[model samples]
Target: MPVKITLAQAMGTCFGVQDAIDMALDPIYRGKLTVVGQLVHNPQVTERLLANGVRIVERDQIDSITTEAVMITAHGASDSTKADLQKRGFTVYDATCPLVIRLHKLARFLEREGWFPVIVGKADHVEVKGVVGNLKASAVVYHERDLEQLRGHERLGVVSQTTNRLDKVNTILDAMRKLPWVREVRFIDTVCQPVKERQAAIATLLEADIDLGIVVGGRNSANTAKLREVIADRGIAAFHVERPEEVEPRWFVTRRHVGITAGTSTPQDVIEAVYQRVREIVAQPAAADHA
Candidate 1:
């Protein structure tokens, strides 16, 4: 009696992550280039890049970098940060996702047009930081409560971190519509297509009658967290795990159907490992009720 296993259509690493790793591993960059940050959020991916001779410099320890050149993460960095790296004698290899590049430009353009820039994301997230850092003054908000921090600006400009949940972005957009004193609101939809598809896949998973959701990705991955959050909001228990062994057998005690999804930063092998572990748990004859 095999338990049914379902996988999301848009699961695993996106093209952006793949491209970043490819560029870093290429002969031209392999020995000479250092990455300014984790190329992508997945630990496995990071480890692989490290094995391939890519040096990663964390933001806190960025000053210690001695490489002649550095590759920007797929998440991107501010224009000033790029310029500063050049000034420090390191040639920059910008691996910013094209979609993210668009948002960075949109934020600057809005500021140039006199609209106050606002970012919908975690303030400390590297991607959001990069976006806001491009502007002299900008606001970052993740919820309605954060709106209180907004300075008095008659016109509002909004863009979101590419990996943020769409519902969250929409909530912020709706809030922007209600600012009575604001004369104008301009928003650019910068959410990535892969994220949107993965988010929508959550609904399909729930409709399929899965007892639980297993989200595979790095713990620091924002998009992966969003996947778990979406499933949990629908009242189904979900586990965000980086590897197969992280899935506890206790959780599968009575689960006959399980849904699996992976974040954009997750690699394909991690998802398969989790799926295999789920199957192993369900095959236990002694654990009669366990699916």
Candidate 2:
């Protein structure tokens, strides 16, 4: 019997990620540019860029960079950081996603208007760090327990990491409204549309008769991990893999209907590669024996 494969309606890299990758690979700067961070969360994309002679360095290692120019990742950077780079005499190339830029602007605008800025995202995430950097006062909260930091403040201004789960963002928002000390609350929705659509698509894909899900993206990718979490939340078996070689044949031996989804930073070609691998796996006789 031929196993059936279904793909989520909305999956794979968003325009912002794609644009950043294009800029990094552009022939004009391929050899001269050094990206300040992983251009995107996907290792495959990173490897491809490296193969094309692009240089990537960690934020802390920027001091070691000898390149005359540097590109910011899609996650973005604080204005101060950009200014400092320019002050150091390096030509700066910004690849900040427009949505992330909007979040930074909204947070600053809120602070200017007398609201205490509160960002909803993982405190350590590069994107969140960019938004929180240089702010006079800000609190990063990903759970209810973190809300305690927001107390003693009368007014709060909130924005979220573009890749944060909408449900989590809403839960935090609702809880903030109930805090007795918070006299005034202002919120600007910062979750990007691509994330929202992928989330909604996964929910729709779960309604299908698939016995398992394959989530493709880099292991460190926050959005990719969230896709796997969503599948697990629904009690569906899932395999989250970063490469086609990681898709084991054993996963499909007993699964006739498999659903495939990918994180927003995952490339289209990567998704297709995984799909083709799945087809090849299911087509082999005694597929489980290859596992």
Candidate 3:
């Protein structure tokens, strides 16, 4: 009467999330630490850090904090944000993933050279906001229809939010190339490898014999939302939950196989908890049927 639960091979935290946590826990800045944003978009991680005495501060409140050093989240920030913190006499420990920093540098370089930068990302995401806020002449393009709005720009430089879907970026680029007055279009693929790998792994899961999908991460996490969106696109029932308790028993009633995938920011323990809960639900039916 025992039930079986299988987790995705590549589920849990990515390198960027690991790096951010490591940087935050570095010995030098042990006492009186403040993070500019949610460290990596996992509630459990944030809560753990909070219990450890790390303070999470909003962007506007960083200037008001009295900490010796403030950490930036893995989702990279603008140069201006760092400059502001430095102006306030706080040593800034940048926890941004190297890949995201690379994209920020590319955006600045392209902008300085007179190329209008086009960022393919959600406008409200903290990472995209930081990226766009740094640029002097850049625009955030979320959908393919936004392409028509770029009627006057001659030279276009394209970069994507580090966690965006590669296929979406490619589709947008292909559409931009068809614009009549657009002279030259150059795209720097900025999608993080971890995100791409996670997405691809989920795609493979969709093709498998799974009845439902469970995605775990912070509610405000853009990448996590995208993961849910990707799974939902397959027309299968998918639930994005932060913790195991959020899993609904009804979702598993008739399911023979359940696929579990977590975002880059999701912790290993949370994934295991989800699996354990699913197994618990499955076991009930098996027990009754056997009885």
State how far residue 171 of model 3 sits from its true place (Å).
Answer: 2.3
lDDT (Cα, tens digit) per residue for candidate 2, span 142-253 = 9999999998998999999999888888999999999999888899999999999999989888888678999999999999999888888878899899999999887776
Question: lDDT values of the candidates?
Answer: 0.87, 0.91, 0.83
- Runs of candidate 2 with Cα error greater than 4 angstroms are 289-291
Better of 2 and 3 by lDDT: 2
Clashes of 2: 0
All models, RMSD in angstroms: 1.7, 1.6, 2.5
- Write model 1 residue lDDT over 212-242, tens digit each, in one string: 8999999999899999999999889999999
Ranking by TM-score: 2, 1, 3
Worst 10 residues of 3 by lDDT: 1-10
Write model 3 residue lDDT over 4-84, tens digit each, in one string.
455776767999889898778776666678999778888889887877777888887765787888888988888888898
lDDT of 1: 0.87
